[model samples]
Target: MKKNILLIGGSYGIGLELVKQLSEDYSVYVASRTSEGLEGTSATHITFDANTDSLDITALPNEIHGFAYCPGSINLKPFKMMSLDTFESDMQLNFFNMVKIVKDTLPLMTAGGAIVLFSTVAVGSGMPYHTSVAAAKGAVEGFAKALAAEYAPNIRVNVIAPSLVNTPLAKRLLSNDKKIEMMSQRHPLKRIGEVEDIANTAAFLLCEKSSWITGQVIGVDGGMSTLNLS
Candidate 1:
């Protein structure tokens, strides 16, 4: 039998790439706000807004082998300019909703299953202007580790912390050639990340090959989280 995987916010970016790859072998259920780019795929799409709506658990399969939460925010601002509401909103989207989804889906996951969540390089490596997002993703890192320990020997939970991926979510930061070059050069790999770069790693963690791995924060950030090439 094919494994059942649930992907939250799988309509675009890295999530979309995951849907394309995983659907070939596994049954995928995509939950996102729109299905614009998911046409011509066998994956099932469910309308969901992590910011407002709760997931309809009845729509998911009884036995889920993989779960990936792909919704996140990139709010870059100085600490002084960032407000309490900004922090709250980021936490809601990046951390709270993720926790809720896992809680709701935990019962559905089969033994040896895996859960993948997204984080950012900023959470580990300090970067200016990443106050809001880093703070939120920081919680995600902690949550992933704790949940992994809590569900050990059964479900594996891991987080991918990426740096400046060239997705719609980071379009603003990479809009101009100068901005792209600048961001690209900031990393030791001399290029920003692609959606597939992160998606592939996420897929691995969800697969049986990585069954031994859990409670780890894997960095998919073009060598940004480590190395001092400068």
Candidate 2:
């Protein structure tokens, strides 16, 4: 039987890549605000708005083999200039929304199933102008670890922290050639991350190949989180 996987925000970016890759072996259900970019794919598209609406659990299957929450925020600002609303909004989008989706979908996950959530390299490396997003993703890392512990022997939970991936959500940061080159130079790998860089790791964790791994935050950030080869 084909495994069923749910991707909460798979309309684009890393999520879309996951849908494309995983669809070759699994039945992928993608939920996001719009169905654009998901056309002509084997994956099923379900309309969802994580910011203004709650997850529609009724559309999910009774036995889910994997779940990935890919929605996130990138509110980069100086700590002193950041507003409380900015912090709160980031938390809502990155952490709280994921929590709600996981809680509602837990019942549908089969034993030994996997859950993947996204964080950021900033959470561990402490980059400048990442206060809001870092704070939100930091909570996600903590939540993923705790949830992994609580759901042990049944469900597996993990997080992927990536640095400056080239995605639509990050277009502004990499809009110009100069900005792209500058961002690329910051990483030890000397290149910005690609969606597949994170998506492939996510797919591994969701499969039985990583069945023994749980409660961990794996960095897919091109060695940016642990290296400083300046």
- Among all windows of 10 consecutive residues in model 1, the one with the lowest summed lDDT is 221-230
- In candidate 2, clashing pairs total 0
Q: Residue 177 of candidate 1: its Cα lDDT?
A: 99
- Which regions of candidate 1 deviate over 4 angstroms? none
Writing each residue's lDDT as its tens digit, candidate 2 over 93-124 gives 99888888888889899998999999999899
Candidate 2 ranges beyond 4 A from true positions: none
Each prediction's TM-score versus the true structure: 0.98, 0.98
Per-residue lDDT value at 123 in model 1: 89
Instruction: Give RMSD to native, each candidate.
Output: 0.8, 0.8
Q: Write the per-residue lDDT of candidate 1 for residues 145-166, one digit (tens) a residue.
A: 9999999999999999998899
For each candidate, how many residue pairs have backbone atoms clashing (under 3 Å)?
Answer: 0, 0
lDDT of 1: 0.93
